[model samples]
Target: MTGISGGGVMTERKKKYGGLRSGQTIAICLAGLATLWISSGAVTQTPDKGAEESRAARGDQKILVRVRESVSQVRQSYVTVFGRTEAVKKVNIAAETEGQVIARNIMKGAWIKKGQAILQIAMNDRGAHLSDAEAKFEYQRLAYASATKLSKKQFQSRIRVAEVLSNFESAKSELAEIRLDIHRTTVRAPINGYIETFPVGVGDYLQTGEIVATVVNLNPIRVVAHVSEREVTKLRVGDKARILLAEGVKREGEIKYVARIGEQETRTFRVEVWFSNSKKVIPEGLTAELKLKTARKHAHKVSPAVLTLNDEGIIGVKAVNKDKSVIFYPVQIMEDTNEGVWLIGLPPRLTIITVGQEFVQVGQTVRTSRDEVELKGNSTDFNSVKSAS
Candidate 1:
């Protein structure tokens, strides 16, 4: 009876210990699930807060910048002006005597050589006057001959012979004057050039000193331009220049004259340049642009887009420092060309931002991306670039 009682107690204790062990296992599983849920919630909340802080920081940053450096080269600054071309020399053909135009050998627009006869004038009764003068001269010569022979032979008095000789000389003088008056009928050209116009045709009556035609010498052309007082000092006689026509043709020339006095109305000095027209393609009165090559110097050529104004409204360029901070540097513009502007400030070597230059401030620290910065150096040599920050 004592042994059976002891066995029953051991079985009861085993059952109680098993029930406590099962409860402990269930409690441990519930605690682990709660821990996992709390960790996941923290992971989601931390990222949202970090993203908000990053956006706020980006909004606070100010100013955008680009940098430019200087270079040495042949630079020129040209001013465009409207001008007209003219003939180097022009002449008007006029009638020298009053008469009817009998022959007009040269037509309008015809080219004539110097001293060429352009028209023939028929003088009314000129032929009759010339014949009468010739007859009287012959008569005078016969009378003078007879008187001289008789005086040598002592058949006439000395006084009578001298009086006849005087009469003969007077008749000859009158005849010569008549012949001269008849010869003033033909009109001539005074120069070698193309006839620009003709006011009278054949058979038309013309007066003395009447304009018959206009002639222009087209071998050498002249371009007339005006220069301001500021540019007058840069121009000198014999300076090389270029003449561009409206038709896209270009001709080379040299400055021939620079007026000493300024124009009364425009306040500009007149300048004349001469160019040879071998082909005669450039006509008179054509509009042209004159480009004068004045001087060349060392300068920095940069894109006009990179230029900016400072707080004081001074023209300058932005320069980047070693710390990626920007600073404004004032520059004197030497010239503005089709490619870029020639400037006179800054060092020869520099790193400038080409893209996104309008977004960053002067002193703000930016997380600069190496891909955004392009180093524009003046060199033709090849470079193997590595990533930069």
Candidate 2:
């Protein structure tokens, strides 16, 4: 038992000594690792690099970009609206006399001249009535003359002569009525136009005031359009406008009318533009686009690629200030054409950044590549860009 106890105590001392030695070796290995890291310059170099990068970010680096000097100019601009075309004069022909249609002079879609006969109705009994009335009128006229002559000679009473004169007047009125009926048998066009529709055909009997055909005068065509209340006030009679048809035809015209009152539902007023259609090639009810020159103003034309948005969600293009810092100016676009868009807000002379705008923010310093050629003219002339040194 004594030997066993002694062996157990020896085992405990051995374990304690072994633990101390392992701890000392671990401390020595850590010290070696620390010394190696310091000698390699990694510990000092890492923190220095982070500090250096932070300082450089604070206005230490410059972004490079391409820029141009854009200037605003006074130019003529127009307001374009899509609209529809209409005829200046449209009419419907109707039958004036009750008769059977014996002949139709022209078919629908035929051009007609003023006073040309369009249709002929049978004069049936009208001609015979006129002849009989004329004969009665002649007989009454002779009787009245004989009565007047006898009265003057004291051969007839005044009352009897007066009665004969009255009969003569009544017969004359009947004859005139019959003649008018015969004239109305032939329906004639009132104006020079084209027959749009013909409801009546040959041999068809028509009552008085029944529609016969529809005619449209196309010598002068009018384009009708609706303009909102905001733009209606700028339109006036005699203002020039350009009309473009959907079929790629273009016509120049002038404003013919503008409605004073606006439509209740849409709050838009009607406008009519008139132009000569001597050839009558343009048909009615065609869709058209109208462009009316509103007013002249100073504006800047810039490329669409240069446009950008600011932090506040405002749309504009960034420009380089004299100090090489970015300037964000809000822009109001006036017109957008194939060449470039015309904008209204910008300094008279501005250095606009084109490339690398997305990489920079407002008030950031930038290095710019300048273009040699610039806009030069009368209203708002462009000058050479300042030196980028």
Candidate 3:
């Protein structure tokens, strides 16, 4: 019985020893798993740190771009407006006396001179009336002379002589009225111009103040334009202007008149520019464009491709500062030419980004390559630009 009891106690001791070994094995496996997890995290973090360092290095590098140095110069500005040609003088000739249009001398579209006869009226009883008036005037003159002689010799009373003088005056007035009526029978052109319309035929009877013909004086033709209120202030009488006609003809003119009042519907002012058309090449009612030169200003000329818009939709161009950092300059376009556009509101001396402007942003440091020949002729004349009409 004692040997069996000792064997049972030995078995119990072995079970406890086996249980402690199993617990130690589990702890060792858990320790190995924690070490592997920590090593994997370090491997992932090393790559991420390298990537962040690489991005920082790239950020410090400067973007390369091409630049051109531009200098501002005086440039003449102009205000362009569209309008039409008109005659300097237009007249509707009217008859001054009632008469029959017995003879037609001028035809429509014929150029006539001042005081040229346009129509002739019949003399209907006018000759007879003049002869009768002359005889009565002659008789009255003789009677008045005889009466004055008698009064001077004190052979006639003063009241009787005055009554005889009144009769003579009445006869003279009647004779003068008949002569004046005969002179107005012929209708004449008041000015030199082309006859635009002749409504009456040879037999047509015309009353006083009736239209005889329509005449238009085309020489020294005028260009009429309605200028905006904003632009009207820049114009004045006698200012020089350039005109472009619809048929590609160009002309020079002088501003003849400018209205002090504004048109109600369009809010514009009327302007008239006179151009010499001695050859009568410019006809009335031809569409034209007027370019009125204004004050000269300091401006820069650059290609339109360099123009860009900002976040707020402001038109500007990208340039480089003294520190080689990118900047934005707001610009106003003064004129557009075939070569480029003139820009105002920029610095007198400027460095513009000619290339790679889209890749860089404002306030970014950049590397620039100077284009020595980009800006040629700093003193370019404003007239060199082609007319953009």
Candidate 4:
């Protein structure tokens, strides 16, 4: 019995030892799996090297835009205003005395010289009156002589002789007045001009101060134009100007007068310009354009593309400063040419942006380059620019 019990005890100890060995083996396997997993993760992971290389390549391949600087001539022209053509001298021919129109030889559109008889009045009665006046004057002279002899010889009373002389003189004066009234029946033109209208015909009984015709002198024409009060200071008498007629005909003229007072309603001063119409091409009542030469100024010529608007809606060009900062300058357009526009209120030399101007904003720093090379040392060449029609 003791031997069997000892053998059982040995068997139990063997089973316990085998169970301990199996637990050790399981722990070792778990530790090995954990190490293998960590190593595999480290080998597969990367530091996004491809993305970094792509960013570096992009930075190095960035493009740099080039530009140039150039000088150009810019012309300054004043503002133009519309005006109407007027004659320097205009007159309405009218008769001074009332009479019958016995003859109407002159026709409309006839150029008549000064003192030319345009219409004749019937003077038959007038001539008769003059003849009667002469006869009365002779009779008065004979009567007065007789009165004087009678008074001198003491043959007649002094009062009676005086009364007779007075009666003869009165009759002669009445006849003379009748003759003078008859002589003022003819209608004549006062100046040399073309007849615009003829309102009388033969046998037409006209009253005194009645219009016979309308005449106009067109040798030196006058143009009446209104200028703004703001621009009045720039205008002066004798300033040179150009008048553009309705048919695009150009004529040289000078400022004749500038009104001191302004029109109440328009607040604009009236200006008169005189132009010679030797060809008579500019007719009355035709519209004309007046360009008064105000001043001459030096300005910069820039492309129209570079012009932009600011937040306040002011039109200007973008320029770059020495520190590469952007600056927007408001400019007045002095003139516009075919190639571009002439701008005022800029430095004589400027760094204007030709490209990327629209993308950039005022006060922003940007890389800049000269747009064009200077053709001359100091002088500007504007021959390439065409005149704006």
Off by over 4 Å in 1: 1-51, 57-68, 74-80, 131-184, 308-316, 321-324, 329-339, 344-355, 360-389
- The 10-residue segment of model 3 with minimum total lDDT is 380-389
Q: Candidate 2 on 111-175: residue-level lDDT in tens?
A: 99889999999988887898899999999999999999999999999999999999999999999
Clashes (N, CA, C under 3 Å) per candidate: 6, 0, 0, 6
lDDT-better candidate, 1 vs 4? 4
- Report the C-alpha lDDT of model 1 over 1-389, residue by residue, as the tens digit: 89999999999999999899999999999989889988878435435877677556545543333343444665665545558999997998777678888898888888888878788888788788778778877887888889889989998889988888887888788787766656557666777889898888888998888898898988899899998888877888988788889868888888999999999898899999899997877889999998876566566777887777777888877667687776567888876769888887666656554444544445644333343355343111111111111
Candidate 4 colliding pairs, count: 6
> Pick by lDDT: which candidate is best?
3
Best-performing candidate as measured by TM-score: 3
Residue pairs with colliding backbones in model 3 are none
Where in model 3 is the C-alpha error above 4 Å?
1-61, 373-389
Q: Model 3, range 1-389, lDDT digits (tens) per residue?
A: 99999999999999999899999999999999989988888435435888777566555556667799999989999999999999998999988888788999978999999999999978899999999999998998998899899999999889988888898898899899988888788888989999999999888888999998999999999999999999888887988999999768999999999999999998999999999999997899999999997789999999998898888999989999999999999999999989899999999998999766766779988777776644333222111211110
Per-residue lDDT of 1-389 in model 4, one digit per residue for the tens? 99999999999999999899999999999999989989888546567999888556544432222233535455656868889999887899878777789998689999888888888877756777788788878888888889889888998888888887887888789786876677567677888898989988998988888888988889899889999998888998998888988767888899999999999999999999998998776788989999887777778877787788989999988877777777888988887779778888877776777765655567766655455543241111111111110
User: How many clashing residue pairs are found in candidate 1?
Assistant: 6
The collision pairs in model 2 are: none
Stretches off by above 4 angstroms in model 4 are 1-77, 138-183, 295-298, 337-340, 364-369, 373-389
Q: Model 2, stretches more than 4 Å misplaced?
A: 1-59, 144-166, 310-314, 373-389
Query: Under the 3 Å rule for N, CA and C atoms, how many clashes does model 3 have?
Result: 0
Error of 1 at 194 (Å): 1.9
Which residue window of length 10 is worst by lDDT in model 1? 380-389
